[model samples]
Target: MKKQSYGMKWLSVEVVVILVGLLFLAPFYFVLTNSFKGFAELLVDTSGLPKSLSWDNYARAWEVLNFPRAFLNSLLITLFSALCMVVAASMAAYRLLRHPSRINRVLFSLFVAAMVVPFQAIMIPLVQVGNWLQFLNSIPGIIFCYTGLGVSFSIFLYHGFMKSIPLEVEEAAVMDGCNPYGIFWRIVFPLLKPMTITVIVLQSLWMWNDFLLPLLVLQKPELQTIQLATNTLFGQYLKQWDLALAALVMGIVPILTFFLVLQKHVIQGITAGAVKG
Candidate 1:
């Protein structure tokens, strides 16, 4: 066998991919660069780099966004929401795979169906229900909401991953001394690390960056997450671009870092999940 020759067609495709990647990255460039500029400088030269790097905007944004509290709020909501989705989805998926009875099949179909139903369509009703249940204006309420929204897609992924796992493994565990919960926790769950990381990363990105649900539920300033807190920089009369951008940078860095660290697992998990389910 010989190496394939490089051609213009491949070069063209590579260039196109690079351009598209840059297009997507443009917003990040703008946000990061402008965050260091003054309001006047940003307005004067939207695309140009700042004449001098300034840390004042970030300092002000830190205090304005109440960085620590906001970060904590976002972190807690994301963590708990991911936890709820993972445990519920993985167990449900495992059960569905192991026993594909009529009711279970129908239940799985409903979970798939729920994935297609856009959240916007059910937003109002969900809000009303939350209000009725008195779960509004609280961190737990938002985490609860995230769980409900995220579980379907997560279950779908886990169901696929579960199918990839041989039943003989579970049987072996049963033959040894492992009970149901023991088999799941000690034997199966560890094997699900890739898919679990995928679910956590995906859900964390959603919950961490989420604005609409948090806005609707959390009205108190003290309850604000990173996105909600950063949004305070914009008003009808004035938009604090520099500070807002700085806060925005702060808001995105953690989630971006998280995705970078676990991105390989994400691809593997999604591929594994898609193999059967």
Candidate 2:
């Protein structure tokens, strides 16, 4: 009787887990299915499967959104932003960990505290500052903002992972006459892969899907990222559901592929803090 009860409890838990997962995936199903339907069909039957799948919407949206240009813009922004955060955070965290001076400690605390400061609180000031610095309305400008916003959390993650790496590794490098730059670039930085991949994946997803920041920083249609290009489908009066959904699906695919490829490293990153090098 006890064993049977335990088996039933486990089965119940599995059922609940599957249900919750499907609940989360419901939006994806809606978006994908609706993307295949005509705009009228979508409005008529949102819950039902499309009568037939058609690539017509994809074709139209691709040209309308200028997927190639928007994709290139998004790719550049995400790539550069992620790289800047990884490099800056990794180096800063290494300094904080290895040096442990009073000022460094205080700076580390400030970084942690900054993580809790909502972007909304600084949005207006950020715009003013960016304008003053001539850092608005360009891809590089947005990358700069993303780096500043992302650095705090990235440093925190690197700080944890850096703890797993032994100090003796750097000591040996020092004895071998490896300069500080060489020690960091060659020895320490390679050991940071798991967390590095994690930061890249997380930040890439955010910058790729993010609409608001790009909308603010990139006003020129020529500078539009995929999210902003997709937004063009919605006007003051009419929202082109078919084209919009298709563009959304197109926008989702590349980043989805990126995450799937690097997901193992993401898992490793999550567990890195518990295990030592």
Candidate 2 steric clashes = 0
On the 0 to 100 scale, the lDDT of residue 175 in model 2 is: 99
- How would you encode candidate 1's per-residue C-alpha lDDT over 100-155 as one tens digit per residue? 79999999999999999988899999999999999899889988999999999999
Alpha carbon deviation, residue 153, candidate 1 (Å): 0.5
Mark the 10 consecutive residues where model 1 has the least summed lDDT.
1-10
lDDT for model 2: 0.93
Predicted candidate 2 versus true structure: per-residue lDDT over 39-118, tens digit per residue: 99999999999999799999999999999999999999999999999989999999998888999999999999999999
What is the lDDT, from 0 to 100, of the residue 79 in candidate 2?
Answer: 97
Candidate 1: which stretches are off by over 4 Å? 1-6
